[model samples]
Target: MTVDCAVIQRETPAPERPHRRTEGPVRTCVGCRKRELAVDLLRVVAVSNGNGHCALTVDQAGNLPGRGAWLHPDDRCLQAAFRRRAFGRALRITGSPDTSAVVEYVRAQTGAD
Candidate 1:
C-alpha cells in the first residue's frame, strides 16, 4: 500500500559499470576436476629429495609455490587420488606421501575420514 522511494532508490540505468571482474581463487582436486575454493583443497607439494621414503608432503598453509596438487578432505577421495597417482601426475613429480600424517591432519582439520 506504500512505496518508500527514499528507502528504495529508483533502478534507473546508471553509467556503464567499469569492466571489473570479481574473481575468487580456486584449486582443482587431484581426484576431481571440479575447481574448489582455494582453501577448500589440501595442498600437496613434492619434497626436496627426489628419492626418499616421504618425498611428498601436504602444504597446510598453501605457502609453497612449487606446483601444487589438491585433494578433498574425504577419505575415499584422497585414497582414490593417491591410488591413481593423481598428485604425482598433476605435479609431474613424487616420492612419498606421509598418508598417515595427512589423514591425521585432515581428520583434525576437517574431522572427516
Candidate 2:
C-alpha cells in the first residue's frame, strides 16, 4: 500500500484567531482580588483626616495623587475588604484607615442600607 504523504503535506493550516487587546489599565480588586479594568473599579487613596490619622477617600475621577487601592463598587466587596483588612495593607498605611467615605459611597451607589 502506498502512503499518501503528498496529501498530508498539501493540507492547509488552520487560521489563528486574533488576540483581544485590553483597552485601558487593569487593576485588581483588593476585596475579591479579581483583576478587572481600571475603569470598572473604584480608586481610593489614603489621606490625613486632620487628626493625624489616615483615611480612605474615594477618587471618582481617578486623578488623586498618592498610592491608591482598587475595589469594586459593590457592598460585598467593601465588606470583604474590611473583613480582610486589605485597605491598610494594600495602601501601605499603619493602623486602620477610616472607611466611612468608601462605605458611604458604595452604599449610595448600591442603594444598600
Clashes of each: 0, 0
lDDT on C-alpha atoms for all candidate structures? 0.71, 0.91
Tens digits of per-residue lDDT, candidate 2, 47-82, equal 988887998899998899999999999988999999
Give candidate 1 misplaced runs (Cα > 4 Å). 1-23, 50-54, 94-98, 110-113
Which residue pairs show backbone clashes in model 2?
A: none
Error of 2 at 86 (Å): 0.6
Model 2: weakest 10-residue lDDT segment is 3-12
- As a TM-score, model 2 comes out at 0.81
RMSD of 1: 9.4
Q: What value of lDDT does candidate 1 attain over all alpha carbons?
A: 0.71
